[model samples]
Target: MGPTGDGGGDGAGLVVIIVLAAAAVVSLLVAFGYYCYIRNKVSKHLNKLKRNNEALEKARSAVEEEEEGEVGPTVVTERGVQVFGFKQLHSATGGFAKANVVGNGSFGSVYRGVLPEGRKVAVKLMDRAGKQGDEEFKMEVELLTRLRCPHLLGLVGYCSDNGHRLLVYEYMANGGLQEHLYPDGGSCGGVSKLDWETRMRIALEAAKGLEYLHEHVNPPVIHRDFKSSNILLDRNFHAKVSDFGLAKLGSDKAGGHVSTRVLGTQGYVAPE
Candidate 1:
């Protein structure tokens, strides 16, 4: 009877140990599942944060590019004129399509374009084999950078990359004064005859532009190529002097004049 009682007790003890082991395995499995669920949740949250950060960075870059009108990094001339990339200007001008051309000159052609910031602009693309060489291009950039007046055409930027030279200006919706004075084969057409009052206003504005360049600014500028075509008008018929490719920097010395070979439009050249 004693041995039987001992055996029964041992059997009961073995059953309790087996049950406890099984319960521990189940508890471990539950804990592991809960850990896996938490890990997956944390991973998803991290991925979402990463995506949001990437999107924000892209937005910031676009804003910067539009504001600066530069690629890779900001490049400004000595006079605070922005420098643009060749690709940027090319894209803006729609690959310099014939349909986008607004004007053609001895040096190159001008195209109307919309910038990335949605601002209308005029791009003057210099011809590779034009008479205007690198010196003229550089002179225009330098002179335009220093000359800033309401009556003068505003220089938006310039591009000089891989032998591609171009100048960017604020778009003049009314086109050039030549178009209004002589409408045949001009850029802006659907316009009626200019009234006496309107003509006088345009003349006065043009005079103001010249006065600003000749008197107001120190070391006056000489618009060597002043002509009807060089005088651009805005949407409100406000005259703004354009085209400084042949501009010469005047001397500040009393009675001093820049002596150079005469170069201007045939009919517009001054007989000095």
Candidate 2:
């Protein structure tokens, strides 16, 4: 009888040991996933000055090429990005009327415009001041024109005429994810509360966009300004990643690592 009691105690202790081992394994898997996520965040942020300086050079070269009307595949003119006539966009937006305005930000405003061909497009008009919004404009022009990820926002065209800067993209009917996620308690665009299934689907689509950038692209771009606001949705609630303004260009030389201060939204940056 005493031996049987001892055996039962041993069995109970074995069960506890197994449970502890299982918990340790789960913890390790969770840690590894987080590590991968941080790695995909492009590792380190580049110093503001360096980023700006390099951006200036890139934007300068691109602008110069556009100005010169260079041909062949090397020039942006020959690339997929169409050079929209400033007057056309001006007319489309009804002289940049406030009524057509759909969104506004530090760089400029976004207007819902209808192309002359009856195609609906979103036109981003950057208030050109001290070369203020040129870097972001050029970045989108350069990157979006080259990268063809389906989950990424499509650049329909752009206007860089007479010192005016405008970016035209395929209109996202549903607007940004942020709008739906946190409504103003009035005119909530999407369902009052996004069901778990819908939320998971949006997350999956966004991840696909990031995965394409992280693995498929030649140099592997890193979106430093990743957030819900940048994730736009279509009429069918399909998500597409937008806003390549603050993304990092990770080349072979850089090895996806840079040196500098932390960047991104206050609450969203590496909160691990």
Candidate 3:
């Protein structure tokens, strides 16, 4: 009887050992599955963050370019038609190089660039973010395409690409009237003397240009931001109005007096 009892006790101990071994194997499989799940989740989250960062960087670059007055390729004249190539303008302006900047205004920066054809031109760069700029670019193209007058600033051409808007014009040798009137590091009290005859001629010539904009065109144009700075002169001192960013066409058809948020240089702005 004692021998039979010992054998049964040994058999029971063996069964218990097998049960524990099976439980250990099950635990290991469960742990491995959980680890895989966590690893996949972490990988997915990291990828998402990377994509978001790239998008944010692109947005920041666009804003910075606009604020700093940096623009992309400008348009220019090719024969009688307005034309521009991404590669050509890029090379001409030294990749819109910062060193080429000659002037700046409310609209954008002016770069003095030499074309592939060896023509010197003034490139006016505009901000792509603002609706005001977009409207100005469209209006200039449409209005200039239709009108032809010597007193007005000639639009050689324009470029609309890569979120950049630019206007190209024949470079003025003498620069704008404001530059002559208000030389840097000089007191305004001693502004450059404009003789009576010269001033009178300028007034008349500009008046005729305004008359053309107001009376002759199918839809009258109003130069909202008229100032000495906008009055550019060539080598012969011939006056032609520049900076049409605030110019509007068809003032007659505009709704309810069309009030604009105040624009132009402080001293040059017209009183409402």
Candidate 4:
């Protein structure tokens, strides 16, 4: 009887130990599952935040691009002249560096620049304190926008921003006739001297340009500052009349002359 009782006690102890070990294992598995759930939740949250940040950045870039496209004011006229943004011109001329300077006049300086489309252009940067006033600037823009002739310089665009006035024109490779006629230690010195035939051709082209302005246009234009320096030549030696800041509008009637202030070069002015 004693042996049987002892055997029963031992069996009970073994059963208890086995149950406790099984409980410990079950607890460990539950803890591991909970940890995995929490880790997965945190990973999903981080991925959502990353996607939202990328979306926000894309939206900001779109707004910036829209603003860049709308830099200058809109023009209602259908003329060929474009209204350029100040920033675009600034970048084109390399911040208006001195090395890009092609010529200088009493009004301002001209710079050689390349447009974004790889087109070369001449940018005339008007001096704020120079002889040209706002009125003259407006007059030149108005006339150049309307006048279109083979022998006349073409107006590409203009910019009026932050009290800065600039005119954009087609690049004249050969420069002005004055440089060829009289070598004055200028950038156009490397150009060969003009022969008699070339000089006559230039004169004829200049005459044709003046005739178109005086006769063809309804309100005839009088280029008050016509001189050799104002006549630009292309690479092919084709002459084009430029610099219409002092241009005047004459009457359409016959024998009508528009009288204005006496403003022209000393030697080029006609005797009254």
Candidate 5:
């Protein structure tokens, strides 16, 4: 009887031990599942945050590019814009005084002025009541800023303030070709005779300048008022096409834009 009781007690103790071991394994599995769930949640959140950051960076870059392309002042800053101050123009043109007057036109007067750095320039004062007015001013400013040919006059600066408008350009020492072709005030003898070579050179240069204006820039530029008087001569007798108030730019196709008002001087106008 004693042996039977001892065997039964040992069996009961073995059963209890097996039950406790099973419970321990169950607890470990539950803890591992909870840890895995927490880790997965953290990983997903980090990935989402990273993607949002990339999108934000891209938006910022695009805005910067637009700003740089749009409102930038200098041509270098923006790709095509040129910005000049009113003060610089005033100082360069001798405050638009009468003593600096060099020539006059239907819409404006030209003045010869010297800059602080000893650079000589010609300033054209635009009349506020002119027919083209703001449109001509805008065209001249836009076209001159992009034009960089050796045969084209360089635009220095301009001023618009208190009903005053002006355009500044490089000074031409010999004046316009018209002066040499037809002298004013009965000074036919005052005009210089053109040799064959000089005449040919002038024609060739004029053609080349027009060709560049028609073919070079992104949008072709046409000098609607091209004539002998509009052609200026420098000290070295080099011809420079000037006065872009009547210029136009656009398509290569004809009939794209037709001017409402007649352009160019008499006898030089192209038949439309």
Candidate 6:
């Protein structure tokens, strides 16, 4: 040993080394904690992003469901359903002239019209004489939009523009069952094309249509205006239920049902 002071200096250096080592360990621990914090944040952000993407996908699917088939609120396009313009229907029905009138009913006169794509259609211009109100017209459109059945009349489209309420329907080549069953003025007296077998078939098909509304649809639909004139026929005499001016949505199943008013054909009315 050189000097006693050298021992003191060595002791001081050892203590400094120990302190430095402790500081380094603490720094490493702090770095690890910061890394863990950053990782946790990134994981949370990813989870949130995943949830957002799932929500977006679900929304897209719901939109696709509503837009399924030919359903939209605009005309102009050749589709299974539409919301037509007043001008378009006016032109199609020859300005609602007398010549285009095919049949007259409690709602209004039915007119034959040809769409731009050469598609034959029947346009029923709701009578402005207060027989049909806005609520009834809107309800009919809403129900037809949701209701789709083979035996039930298909609502091709409608027009609620320019203070006018008109419904567009698929042109039934055979016309109304009434027209074929009981012809007026000319083809009177005898049995028309509707034979006994055909009449039975028509009756079955019509019942099926009504059954669909009663059992299939939720809350059920009441065709308050069920009648022979409301039954239309295809080219093959296949009957489909048409017209829903006085249709009503039923209440709870347990409570049965109540009619707000009696508005159907007097003779055809179901005697309560």
Best by lDDT: 4
Quote each prediction's TM-score: 0.70, 0.66, 0.63, 0.70, 0.63, 0.67
For model 5, what is the alpha-carbon lDDT of residue 82?
Answer: 33
Task: Give the Cα-based TM-score of candidate 6 against the true structure.
Answer: 0.67
Residues 1-272 of candidate 4: C-alpha lDDT, one tens digit per residue? 99999999999999999999899999999999999999999999999999999999987876675358544333437877788777778888999999999999887899998887799999999884645578778988999998989999998899887788999999999999988877866655566488889999999999999999988998999999999899999999999999998898999889976678888787788777
Structure candidate 2, residue pairs in collision:
none
lDDT of 5 by residue, 1-272 (tens): 99999999999999999999899999899899999999999999999999999999977875665444432123344424334345455666677788888888886789897766687888787885855788888889888877889889888766565667777788999888888777663445566676778877877887888889988875788788998888888887788899888788767665466445567787897576
How do the candidates rank by TM-score, highest first?
4, 1, 6, 2, 3, 5
Cα shift from native, residue 92, model 3 (Å): 1.7
Go through the candidates in order and give each one's C-alpha lDDT: 0.85, 0.82, 0.75, 0.87, 0.77, 0.83
| lDDT of each residue in 218-241, candidate 6, tens digit only | 888889888888899999999999
Please state the error at residue 149 of candidate 4 in Å: 0.3
Off by over 4 Å in 2: 1-77, 185-191, 253-256
For candidate 1, the 10 contiguous residues with the lowest summed lDDT are: 66-75
Q: How accurate is candidate 3 locally (lDDT)?
A: 0.75
Model 2 poorest 10 in a row by lDDT: 66-75
Off by over 4 Å in 4: 1-77, 130-132, 185-192
- Write the residue-wise lDDT of candidate 3 on 63-154 in tens digits: 67644445443333433436554445666778778998877866778888887678888887776467877888887777776677888988
lDDT of 2 by residue, 134-220 (tens): 888888888999999889999988888888999999999999988888777345454546678888989999999999998888788
lDDT of 4 at 259: 72
Clashing pairs in 1: none
Question: lDDT order of candidates, best first?
Answer: 4, 1, 6, 2, 5, 3
Give Cα distance to truth, residue 131, candidate 5, Å: 6.5
